[model samples]
Target: MIKFLIKGILRDKSRSLLPVIVVATGVFLTVFMSGFLKGIFNDIAELNAKFNTGHVKIMTRAYAENKDQVPNDLALMDVKKLLSQLKIDYPDMEWVKRIHTGGLIDVPDSFGETRGQGQTIVTAIDMLSPGTHEVERMNIKKSIAKGSLPVKQGEALISDEFAERFGVSLGDKVTLFGSTMNGSMMFNIFVVSGTLRFGNTILDRGAIFMDIRDAQLALDMDDAASEILGYFKVGVYDDIKAQQLQASFNTKYSLKDDEFSPQMFRLVEQEGLGDYLKLANSAGTIMVFIFVIAMSIVLWNTGLLGGLRRYSEFGVRLALGEEKKHIYKTTIYEAMLIGIIGSVIGTGMGLGAAYYMQTYGLDVSSITSNIGMMLPSVYRAEVTPSLFYLGFFPGVIATVLGSALAGFAIYKRKTSQLFHELEV
Candidate 1:
């Protein structure tokens, strides 16, 4: 019976072609949109983890509240001891200390007079430690436009754009003028070992990277760090796991009453990101739901129209002693076959397009240039397991449902009406 139906559908394009096209179009949109949205959300989470927050971040309660100020005054103290304890307590994670501050970069001329000055945001991390992963984690080596990674004390990397604006080059001396953690005047000279282009407009505008030890000395923040970042050994952000870890650490070490006490926060808990993640998820769900409903209505109408055109044929079948239930079931089976074929074609096309996007990505640098948030300029689609089967829901179920609704009219025809129709 199924083979006969398949042959019939193959022979008669009118009965199958239009419905298949509709299902294919719907499935394509469903699959592509699912992959695209998933990619965007994942990128947001990963970028945040790499640049700002880690899987989890620890800071003083005061610093967590006023983090926007880069409050080194409220930074964590005795970080070495804290780091040792963290490594012992959480063997499954990697902990690193980081310092963030803002200061002026003053370039000096041949006679020692200031040549040019600009403000910059400075980030210091463990670049010189043995077996350190900061350089790889931030893709610093790959992003270098000129010169090389800092290999010694008092060496640093400046943004390529900043270097150009100031006419600075590798091995040139630049003085960092900033206040210490105690709010006193401080200045230190560093050799520009490399120039980098991070591809982020905001960061490229004015940024500097230096060794943690150098920053500690320049900022007078010895034995202190602005934040302690923790990453899972697996290198993926798991919100549930992060939340559990945060709760455990805070319960054990954090003091609610002491503003200076250390506090732990998951990535989702910081930078108003929890709300953004919720909104992204809700948007994807609503989008898929809308696609399913809209496609169902369209395919439903197509089935209804096809059924109207087949009234004469159905009447003949009924007149030949065929049961209405059997005819209706056959129509449903035909719809199912059409749905499967269309879905396969559509899924293949969608995955192909998504793979291209995932590889090349769509550049949106112009659109995001002014945005202060840490968003990548190129947006890529992500193909996940869910995307493999997401299109089938709208493709198969909607097609079958539409056919069932349209085929119900078969039972409504009376025997006398059939005979009258046959006479006509």
Candidate 2:
């Protein structure tokens, strides 16, 4: 039956091409979008994982409120002490690190000087130690133009964007002058040992790195750190564990903690590109509907008269004592065979599109670049098995319905009462 159906359907190639085109197009679009969403999310996650908010961070609540909030002195919020104790008490925490402030970097008389409120933020970091593995120790140091990641006193890494803007090069002595956490002004100079490029315009434009101790001294942080950064045992990580740590802080140190407490650090969830989620799902639905509707109209006209033209075959077969059921079965078998083959081909094309996207990603930026309009660039698009499945099912369903309807209505099948007409 399947072999016969295949031969019959292929014989009338003109009648079956429309559904194949529709299914193939739909599959391509689905995979295209899926690839774009994946790339953007990965970049964001990489950035978050490298920055201070590794797995989880416990900080002064004020820092959470404002990224610019530089508590001049490290205020001992019991939460910091408690997190330290948990690492010792549990042997499950990776060890906590402290951070203090980010101030405007004041460059001396080299190229351009930051006299007033200029560019740059001098954030304090303590994890500049060599051989540190808290987040794989992102090697922004290698991308440096002047110096390396700050580990010692009087050494600062300038952002590449800033260096280019000011014409500062590697190994140049630069001055950092800004107000301390105490609101008292201070000036410190360091050798430009590293210049790092972030690929992002914003971070490269004004970001600067300094040792935790230097930042504390420059900002008058005293013995306190602005916020406590944390790393946990490799296996003991994730939201649930983060929540448990949060609970421990709130339940154990809520009252005992003075300056810092539950309000301090948020459960540092990694940033991911979730922009695809914002796209209207109805968009795909509407496109598929139009495609289906268009195919139905085209197929209906093609199949209707086409099936009626086969009336002579049905008439002769009936005269030969072939039952009506046999004719219907043959017609359905032909239609399903065409539908299944087209579906297989369509699925293969769709997966190929998905794999291509996995390699190069969607080019949405072309829209912006061509039109000169401001648009957010995305990397990978969101994809799922369901999208391909959706495409294949519609082709099969439409094929069966179109074929069955045409066969049933136009078999030119003579009713017993119509025998006289046939004889005449």
Candidate 3:
């Protein structure tokens, strides 16, 4: 019976052809679309990590609120101390780094090469414990195109784009000047140590790196850091986890009874970086809708034909004393086969597409002018296992299997009515 069913399906090549093609196309689209979304999210994650935030950052109360607290005051230095003590207690949160940020500065033609103020950006950083901010520092360092990192207070690292923006080369003497946190005048001479390119437009265009000491002194904060940056292997992007880890530093400093605002949690999601998160979510939802609508049409049409054509065969099976359930199961098996085949093909195609896109980011600059973004426009698909599960596999299986079962519903009738279907 099974062999005969196979032969019957194979004999009607034209009827079966579209179904297979539909399955394959649907599967392929699911995988391809999912991988694309995953890629975009990953790129955004990387961008955020390199330029703005890590998995999470702990900022001072006023800083997150933008209420204008002292620019360089460490509102939570006690919290950092508590972190050290908490590590002794919990041991799980041994990794944490303090990060301080300050105003942008420009190197003048007075010191050396003539990159005007508009062309250069200098940012001050402080090294906490010579330990923290090291890994990120290295990552930030490698992105540099030329010149070495500035280890001492006087030295500085300039991004490659800044180098090109001002047409300055390595070893160029640049004068760095910026307002202190106290609004006092500040100036320092820095040798261009390295050129940097971070794949982030803002960072690439106008960002400079200096030792934390340089940042603190340049900003005239004097041992006052903006926030304590920390590192941990897990529990990133969770405010509750941060609150729990705050216990690890218990002995180092006292934790106030005060509650931290949701804004205090500096996860990428909470920071509200806009489309960095929104576009990803939107794409995922959009893909699902498209897949459903697309698959529905494909399945409904295939099911109708597959059902009507097989009606006579089903009637004959019933006449031969095959149970209705048995017929349904057989049809389901056929649907499963088509689904499996389509899913395999789709996954393979989707992976290939994703890999290609990852290597060459989609250039949307041609349309950016039309869309009008203040930032440079680039889009890359983000791929993840979740995306795969959501987009490709489920859609194919549900559509194919459901379609096969739906096809069998057309076979429903009394044994006396079997001849009627056969006659048609």
Candidate 4:
């Protein structure tokens, strides 16, 4: 029976071509859109983790509340001891110290006079520590648009754009004027070892990077850090595991009554990211739902039109003693076969496109430059294991559903009335 249906569909292009084309196009879009949306949301999460938040972050309760203000005065104290204990307690995670401070960078001329100055946000990390992966994690080496990574103490990297704007160059001395952790005025000079462009507009605007040790000296934060970031050794954020870790660590170390006590926060819990993630997920789901419904309606119309066109044919089959149920069932089987074939072809094409996109992303720097967010310049598609079957939901089930609805008319035509219709 299946062979006969296949041969019939092959012989008659009108019976199979248009519906197959519609199903294939819908499936292709479904797969591609799913991959694209997944890529965008995943990039946002990963970028935040690598640059700002870790999979988990540890900070003083006071600092956590005012983290947006970059309040270094409320930073974690005795960080060295806490870091050592965290490494011992959570061997599966990598721990690092980070300091977030904002101040002015003063560029000096040959006469030791200030040539230029710019307000800057500084991020200090464990760049000089042996066996540390912060450099690779942040893509600092690749992002260097000029010079090289800092090799010695008191050297830092500034944004290439900031350097250009201030007429600064490599080997220039820049004075950092900022307040210490104790809220005291402080000034320190640093050599410009390199310039970088992180491809994020917000970070590349007026940002500076320095070693955590240098920041400690400059900010009077010895054995202290604004925040201690913890990342899974696997370099991926696992929300459930992170939540479990946060709960356990808070229970053991954090004191709700003590503002100075250390507290742990999962990635989603910080920076209003939990809401952002929820919004992204909701948007993706709504987009997919809209596409499916749109495609289903179009396919349903196609099935209805095809069934109407075959009315005379169905009437002749009934006159030849064929049961209405058999004819209806055959139409459904044919639609299923068309759905399967279209889904396979469309999934292959969509995956190929997605793979290419993932390899070489689409650049949207011009569009995102003015936007004050941490989004990357390039957009890529993320083809997951689910994408292999994601298309079948719309391709197979929707097509079959449309055909089932259209086939109901098969049982409505009476054999006695078919003779009168056939004559007309």
Candidate 2 TM-score over all chains jointly: 0.64
lDDT of each residue in 83-127, candidate 1, tens digit only: 999999999999999999999999998899999999999999999
Model 3, 1-424: lDDT tens per residue?
A: 6676577557777545666677667766777767776665655554454334544455555555562333443334444454465457556443343334434445556544445665444444443346555536446655657766665556777777667877777777776665665677767666776777655565666677777666666666554545544445552344467566544333233335432311234344444554566676787778767776777677766777777777777788889998888887877666666666566666677767776776676876455534322332466665556645564565566666557647657456679887775786
Predict model 3's lDDT versus the native. Answer: 0.59
User: Which 10-residue window in model 1 sums to the lowest lDDT?
Assistant: 365-374
Ranked candidates, highest lDDT first = 1, 4, 3, 2
lDDT of 2 by residue, 354-411 (tens): 6666667655544433332223333544455665676666666666666677767634
Question: On a 0 to 100 scale, what is the lDDT of residue 99 in model 2?
Answer: 58
Alpha-carbon runs more than 4 Å astray in model 3: 1-17, 67-70, 73-115, 119-122, 125-142, 151-153, 160-169, 181-183, 232-264, 273-282, 318-329, 351-383, 391-393, 400-424
lDDT of each: 0.89, 0.57, 0.59, 0.88
Q: Give lDDT for model 4.
A: 0.88
TM-score of each: 0.93, 0.64, 0.73, 0.95
- Tell me how many clashing residue pairs each candidate has: 0, 27, 41, 0
TM-score of model 4 (CA atoms) = 0.95
lDDT, model 3, position 379: 64
